[model samples]
Target: MKSQPSLDTSPKVSDEIRKTTCYMCACRCGINVHMKEGQVAYIEGNRDHPVNQGVLCAKGSAGIMQVNAPSRLRAPLKRVGPRGSGQFKEISWDEALDMAVGLLRPVREENPEKLAFFTGRDQSQSFTSFWAQNFGTPNYAAHGGFCSVNMAAAGIYTMGGAFWEFGQPDWDHTKLFMLFGVAEDHDSNPIKMGIGKIKARGAKVIGVNPIRSGYNAVADDWIGITPGTDGLFILALVHELLKAGKIDLDYLAQYTNAPVLVDAETGLLLRDGDGKQLVVDRVTGALTAFDQKGVRPDLRGTHSDGALTHRSVFQHMIERYLDPEYAPEAVSEKTGISAGKIRAIAAELARVAFEEAFELDQPWTDFRGERHEKMVGRPVSFHSMRGISAHSNGFQTCRALHILQILLGTVEVPGGFRFKPPYPKPSEIHPKPHCKVTPGAPLDGPHLGFVHGPEDLALKDDGSPARIDKAFTWENPMSAHGLMHMVISNAHAGDPYKIDTLFMYMANMSWNSSMNTSGVIDMLTDTDDSGNYVIPNIIYSDAYSSEMVAYADLVLPDTTYLERHDCISLLDRPICEADAAADAIRWPVIEPDRDVRGFQSVLCDLGARLNLPGFVNEDGSQKYDDYADYIVNHIRKPGIGPLAGFRGNGNKAGRGDVNPDQLDRYIQNGGFFVEHIPAGANYYKPWNMDYQNWAVGMGLYDSPQPYLFQLYVEPMRKFQRAAEGHGDRQPPNHLRARIKLTLDPLPIWYPPFEDSHV
Candidate 1:
């Protein structure tokens, strides 16, 4: 949807070139902005950069228009007339900071829930989350909740790696690739680059989508399926593999919990007295340790530990999908794919997974003291994103795709789907959200984290939503990213609590960015009985005067991307590849001609004005001179900050003392730094001793213990148990059934809510 950069009529000339990161879109490609004696002449990609290496997208190349737009807000504006009237008067930064402090101080002192902080595609969540936590508010999130959190939650809970940014296919070595319902989005440049490499090497690519444009147009075989039926197709393929006995049993037993015993009565994994999960030994006909040195495990059988009858997790899984109803003929009508075609595709998958595997001549040792000279691989890979994630059944469908990959033994291996760096965070590693707020103190933890059970839910003692977004309630219990779309509607109706202010950054909540344009406009300007606005205050920051500028009660104008200092750190979505970890920053390439500030600088100023906990010194003096000073000095912990590279006394990367000249080092390194991960540590990362040691040493991962791929996630079972009224915290009666069905530990294939009745 981007228009191409126009051809300049005059011959392009350059006086000097400055390297920086691009922000026209979210890709954050590196660029060399050509300056012709004080103005930007042309911009091109930085070839040495890791992200877009010598190539820039249309949006990134069109940044000249963004900086020179005539409608850009040049100064702060305090609305002089009614809200949404497009009425404003320019003011100084001092008055703007005072206004913000006065409006937010009362909300922080009395009830922090009265303020909602959300942003649209905000890239600086590390600073924002800190700001919200220290400000004592539980309502804070970026835009992920309404975008693709379903894909992230499902993939992480299922396998400790996802199919998008957290992981990707080994595209260079893959013989066959399968893309499910993905369009021309999501890490766009990398995907396009990968596809180009695959096609050049004569690999076969298949796409499963309802639409056949964009990337699907290049697919060798495009199988059009009904929407929300991806799980059904995936399970039918699993059924075929089970019937033909074409599974990788050795791979499953070695890397997953396939041999772990599960009790039928309680629907939980059976463990010994020491709490180690037990597995049945085929040679001795007795229970043995899951990690027993020389025991061979039985993958398909029923065994009990005398207290109760039980079966292996693998046995229970096949029992669910091996039914006659899962055959291709049974699901043909629902998927709109004929039985013969479905069988052909399933047969192709089986052949590619088993018969067409490749091998590498690399030496490595697994965790069990076993030595292998070559790494075995299945030359098949997969990817899926927003198309599958924006549905009611998105989580389960994504889990099914992960299960399909695991069954083929294609996770984190050569020529298969691979985990990106900093992934394989312990499968159960997501932190719990801290919901409690206290006057004059920050919350106990971050506002957004994975909720382990009903106990972690951000609800009041009377079961009302504690935060305005209704994120971790029974309505959406597994929402790791707090829901942003529901914040406005929930606050307007006072569904849980009424709010005093809505502070947003880089979001256009008025036009195409939100739902029901007319209604949102009305809600922004609505008044209560006392002639006061229903939403008492509004604050927005944007570089340009988009449609959203007309609605803000206080307009804090922001400098353009080329005129700011920003960091894409490891804490959030930094550009890290499977082979190495990296992060970058954008220092001002040109001075701003307007009386504006970067949003981060403004947030820091607001923090100082309000005397928030971390923004001030012991003597009540400002801790940082500006955003750049904070980026260099602020420490999240003892030794970590924004950038992990070029830390200490100028000789180390990742986990070093904060150097006074950190930004200078980054600029000298061509606007970014990539840590060099050894070649042997790249593959089989969960069990790779070298990778684990390096990751933990770099502060990217917490522990050095080997991470087991979660073939069957157990946290889901706990929630289901709570729903069944057998745990310490039970769901309300209304959500009990919904929780019971969606919280199945195994990947399930059920129709999306609306499709069931249709």
Candidate 2:
């Protein structure tokens, strides 16, 4: 071979820094990319960024590989061989988009709702709501079907908002930090800081898990509880706390609605003859409806406000069970742990609580400063992820945890459980500035069940009410049967709402949802004559092919993390007025590749093309920009960024790192805040004190009766108790007893669903 001419082997440096946010995970980190001669030369974390600091994880490090992967589709391809067979012919964007619109526009005109747009990591910056509404489809489901739907459901039943890791545990003040499933070192960086801080503060760490974790090395003790039995263990601790009388009495009495009963006939709260609602018994901490003779009354009284009550129902429940009589032994037997071990854990927790409360006059802290102290503690909060739930009897297990939290008085406190906010953006269309509303309404029951309050209203393309009722109704008449009803309806009269076009964004449903994957795929393929489904046109924006992509007539190219504009909107901040004084900001460290456009750009284009409405310019015009500009402008926009700027420096206009100065400038510049903007004086309208209160306040008036906050309570206890009271006609299958609980009836346990325990 001839000698090769001398050539430069060193990589060249290029000047290209495009900002974007990481959608790979919920962290939503920001980044700035540096490209070299149109090729990826090297990767560096955007240290000036506010979210990730200068730190990047393994996944973050692999951004270049992901963006330049061989499997990536550089151009649109048509399926020349067969669907899902990976056979294709490259096509231009014009050819692809035109073909997609041709098939979609007509189907949309036919039946709009039958179309289902399943998306994953919808962490895109796009105004997705616009696309769904413009298309007039009610079935814009997401990856939640498999991931966090149930987690949201748990929050719905308790806090009324989806849970976020925003509430910082007071590790600085805590003497004992009991880290649950969250293994500190193994967690993401942001989380690692909190855990690291607590440890540094010299707090004693008690790591609890089924198996030892890296965090276990930091722990003073490891409580090896069986997987999924953590709730029971915690509840037993609550029982011990009550027995030892270690609770914060004033806090419990002032905050909880623990005392109340309802009338059997009325289904509304029961009150005394004086019109005062009956209270739960302080001694038993149960509803105060049982007569002196211990006989439950048939008719409970009404509340002082003449609203229905359920104090009696819950009162009877606690008195009949959950008290000392029911005991830790009962829980122990059901959970497969020994009573001695349960009592021992409870004792250690009690000791920690007494010392932290009585001696310190402040919350105890672990070595670094977390109060999750398991050593003689009062009641530390216990949280669970999908690893603990998502079983056949997940609901029951969740209920047990909620009850335990309530019993421990851990709801809404620092170093304890709290009902925090998910943060909603203000409505730009309102005349008086909807975002400037009061902080809280102190509502009794949920406004819109299951979804975030701000997301309650389903906005059309124009940001107006779509199908007002159908959109907000969390409980469809046939929802209990899952999406099967929609399938049947589509199979027959084509879905009732009639869907024509389906657009999926970053979703790979085949391996995600619990439903039969084959069925879902077939349904996606079963389109109408116009190349629509029970949908017309299916367009998907994703990184790879999965079962969902098999049915897509058009697959839009998606930008990898390295190729997109980065924004940081989800960093941790002050959760309440008290914590508002603390300042913290996180920035992105890397930029996305250039070829891929953020989903926001796609939505902006689609919105303009359809001329739907809402996302207009400040001059009451509609000059919508690409997704990158939308994100940058939204972050840098006036009254849209919060009181603090992205940079903690308090310089509102500062676009790079966050700092105190940036925050001050941000406030002056009308920065958008995570908290609900306060309305003027007298703007704090009390929505509801509880369910009954909400019913009357909202004018869904009913005669004073025992009320259940939940529209329907289908707990297995309801059916089990009925079966025991009646004959042996086994209760309905849905009502069949699964998980057994001393608090209720029946004791059931299901094996964890993982293919391997480890």
Candidate 3:
């Protein structure tokens, strides 16, 4: 016992190591899996990863359990008893594929809308949506509607970027960081690291949430706000800031629509002949396009022509927020926040933003031909997520938070919130929702997207819902992610239309995913007088025997995260950092020990079996063997694909020809690739020409798409206009009043709909 038997202090953990991106959570952290005797021995975060940076969370470290869980579905199962009875017969992959094709082929051949396909939190949405498009189904979406569609839609519409997966607070430089309804589970690792960084630097942290737990518990200050009242509270802050002249007026004039003129009577943006938004030039006292060179926008400018008067959006904002109605005292009772507290917080924000402001030595050019000597900073930042976006007024509340950030000139600036690449691409460039389906042919375009107006609503010629979920209808006009939560219920009720099949991947609709779990279970299992299920044919795919599995007529078993090939594509939700545009790949570190296949790979086979255009070659042969093949070879555009790195002789960063060894390159590079944004283009992204050109070069945009922050979202007004008896595509009489009230272009707070019922 002289030296504890001369124990080896630095013991070897494994014989081999495999690098891949973790799917334990949405953070998509890069991890190193240790293999001992050809089995997973240990898991750790990759130190070289741009995200997490060697910091593995508990969930990520427990990935081995996920891969080897006893509950994982081993084989495809066919229902042998009533739906929800949990009685099933195992089937071979061949038979399962054949049965799926039998159920789906006819639907595609006759009416593809009869097949409602939706996925849940799947990383391969770009591929899944593409498959649905080729299959001609307008009834397709991801689980965003059940998650954070409100935040995503509002963020995209307001600032061309959103928080959570899209952007982050500048932890290194921000002196005061404010969080609204941010839960611990959301963006777990990066945010934890960020908070630690800021705390180490003696920065202040303010958390606003009804529950004083999670991130809020660690906050320097916590605002225990009332439920569903975040919009009112944020507006009160805006009101105080506007009243005290604490707003960044120069930033508003230069980077936001606050300087663009709006027609007072019509509540529409004033535009010139070419349809460009018009702003009043302060220097020349003349009306001109907002993007005109050398035009100094006048925040207080006004114009009149005969019967109509136009005012700057900023003036309208002042008139609306500075009014007594939005005062802290007015909203205090509703928000459950003291008037003094609101005022104090607003003052602190102003002090941190203006008084503690700093500047970077970097110089950059903006889109409007303006150059800056130094990058000016406001050391205040704010972020919010699903906590504030799961209510009746969620969209508006999200907008209000964004408006508050813009008012403080904190977004896309030094020591403020910064957008990751592929964002700051305005709504103008995003696709519109397309429900134009044809028999046996692909849909005209993508199924889910931003809806600009009543014209963009997914309604048929006869004025019925074009989608099974009733998204983009007058009832839910700006359903940017589609109503995935409504699909089963809507299909069962046949409210808008009936579907032949309810096909889903990973979404457990029969349980936790549904608002009324028992009701959804009944909807899934209930039979009509003819003894046929109300939903008719049900097909589902998941790696585990989740509650929804028992309800499916055909259950396709899927592979675990380690046994599948997946892409965090530039076209989908990328794992990007503020300083770099990044993407990662997940490959089979260990082969599945069961009959299950990756859901996406199965889709590839199904697409080929159905002869979906993109999935089949010119000779009608299957174009790709599996998801990995498609990721490497599929050309979305002339020089773009699912993975944006190591293309064309392993040299390209974004756009290039097919690289057969692309996956190998990614694996060699610790299972991820990152292209660092030039230092000069790091901040002030939306208006910076250097960033714009860099984004274009990276194929994030086809061209430099410099756009202003839409403080006054014009698209919402278009819907309001339709409700106000202006456009030909008008809302139903029953819904007109609600549309007009809720779709206000400017962010406004309203009581939760449940309150009215009570």
Candidate 4:
């Protein structure tokens, strides 16, 4: 390899061609760093990376500021004064590690269950999760506890697993792409690329949100719906879909659980062998049963009792939900948006979807053969994040958006709603050498004993969420939120079972969270006679006393992206897409200025210190000593595990021939994916029966609609039936999920835990 000359030295010049993954947001864009000597002088997107394709978002463009921030902690710091004093003394890695161990080891030994590990939204995967597990702590919370868990929960309830990639809209074939509350100012490469292609092809784009976003400006139509009322507007869209009989009923029947009404006891499909069940498909739309067998088979035996059955995913929604009083003529009353505008928007969406279907030479999956499937008669796509999902009814809002996407028949298709990375198989980046979980493995954390196990969230002998881990298996898909009560109880409780220590990594709960901020801080600060709160030993990995760090007993500095060898998968393009023909390379862009290490490195070291078996190699030291070696073991070594023959290393884009030793070459080449195209006439049907699964231990009452953000569907349904049986009028939908405990059954938005008053 030849050394690339520095472009310029005028404060922004670089001679080093460093390739690394962007950590700006979940969109892990492949970033190319041009360094002059050792300083990063310029940054740009890797043109060859297929996912981004020479595009970078505003956040990605500002990567330099993140790495070179003046506030970045350079060395490990020991709190010289009281906790939260923000006064510290620089110390060696040995001292910092020892201080951390001394503080936490005791807490763990006393009550390992009380030691809570909170990880922020960074490079999380099996490797990231291993630390919490090896430590034997029962309470492991993450940013998702506040960020996107609800949406993830919705996906799990509907689909087997949730994916974060939020696949590109089929702009090439889409007639209309809906932008709901996604501000492209903070963007990902795939989204940017997809939008560009859509605009270039002259497809219509609709932006439905309170504020006009950058992406909204480029949309063919922009509708400013009031904040928190996204659910109403989306429901109106579904109402329109049903009113016009334009839904893809056939696709729903074949693919999703939409058409099957599940049994309250078994969580099995409500249907018999031929798909006729207590539930009925009301859409009377497209009826193409393309993959019905595969779709319904997965839904079997996921209820209170273990048995298989059929239920339409769609009909189930209608059975449980009541159409809001806001008609097209009166949507403004409920959503504070004009009814005329709503009708126009609805009409435009339908017209576009229908139009694109013919343009792409595809028929509407529905029987009417309307072009409602796609944007212009193709497929539709929508996304909801912080701004939309951070509301009191955030989870419900997300559920509404998901339902809207399905009604439009835009899910799991090109220009439709598709989940990639962290959900799909053959992940883009190979698992780290010591990585325990398989790539894209879906785990019911609270419901199941561990990841990759069968689900067991069904009722126990007492009719609550089963206490035994056996009830939670990989086979059953349940909500992670159902176990939230447990986390809250643990936080508030001390004796019998309690978390005594807390480890936070790059996480600022008070700064970003929406659940009662002060309460969480109190929990974080819980102490006993010795003045130690529940999290007496707060170990943080951050550069500054940013709220959470201000409370840390020990603060350890960490290597930023430029200074460390990190993996790029969850936020990058879909693994299947990465395995396409070209994949991006993984190499350190800049040498570490200090001894600060990445999270994995610190954990690997800590695991060894604990004398963990898998931490070391045959030579006795840490086997996967460094990240690069770990990458080699997973991506290059053949027959190691699921990642055997993994050929993604180095920098390249698009799918290419798999390389054995040239991991970098395989990475440089775009990754792999099943070359997907328009699968002719696939249909998904909705559940038609009135059914509910029991939610054991959950004081769930019947309501108009009740859905948890994470797993545990059968339990929820069971609660619904129980409520009806009690003649409780199912408690008002608003109050049904309201609980006065630390963990509310439903989401209630509040201010963050810690606030930066200054």
Q: Which candidate is the best by lDDT?
A: 3
Model 1 TM-score, all chains together: 0.95
Model 2 scores worst on lDDT over the 10 consecutive residues at: 428-437
Worst 10 residues of 4 by lDDT: 691-700
Estimate TM-scores for all models: 0.95, 0.64, 0.99, 0.71
Residues 1-758, model 3: lDDT tens digits: 46556779999999999999999989999999999999999999999999989999999999999878999999999999888889999999999999999999999999999999999988899999999999999999987888888999999999998897789998889999999988885589999999999999999999999989989999999999999999999999999999889989999999999999998887889999998888999999999998999999999999999978889999989989988998989999999999999999999999999999998999999999988989989989988888999999999999999999999999999999999888877888999999998999999999888988888999999989999889999998888999888888899899898899989998997543466988988888888999888899999999999989988999999999999899999999999989999999999999999999999999999999999999999999999899999999999998999999999999998889899999999999999999999989999999999999998888999998888899999999999888889978878999989988899999999998977776
Candidate 2 TM-score, true structure as reference: 0.64
Q: Candidate 4's error at 232, in angstroms?
A: 1.8
Our model 3 lands, by Cα RMSD against the true structure, at 1.2
**Alpha-carbon runs more than 4 Å astray in model 1:** 1-12, 272-276, 281-297, 510-514, 754-758
The sequence of per-residue lDDT tens digits that candidate 2 reaches over residues 1-758 is: 99989988874565665444344456544444456666665455546443455566656655667666766556565566444556666677667657765665554555444445445655431245335544554454444434433444443343332234423344334555565544432125544555577668665667667777766565778777676666566566666766676555443332233334545533343556755345554454444432222322222222333553344343443344356544678777655667887777667655655555522232222111123222122325444545444443444455555554444444444444433222111111111101111111111211122322223333333433332123222122111102321332243245224445556676665554345676665665565577644544557776555555566667777656555433333322222221221222222223443334455566666545444334455454544576544443443232333223344333332223334344333323222232222211001011112322222221222211221122112233333343344433233344333311321321223334352435
**Each model's Cα RMSD:** 4.0, 11.3, 1.2, 10.4
> Model 3 off-target regions past 4 Å?
1-4, 510-513
| Full ranking by lDDT | 3, 1, 4, 2
Look at candidate 1 and give me any clashing residue pairs: none
Q: Number of clashing pairs, model 3?
A: 0
What Cα-based lDDT does every candidate model obtain?
A: 0.83, 0.43, 0.92, 0.50
Name the lDDT of candidate 4.
0.50
- The total of clashing pairs for model 2 equals 137
Tens digit of per-residue lDDT, candidate 1, span 590-658: 888999999889888888777888898998888877888988899987788888888998676778889
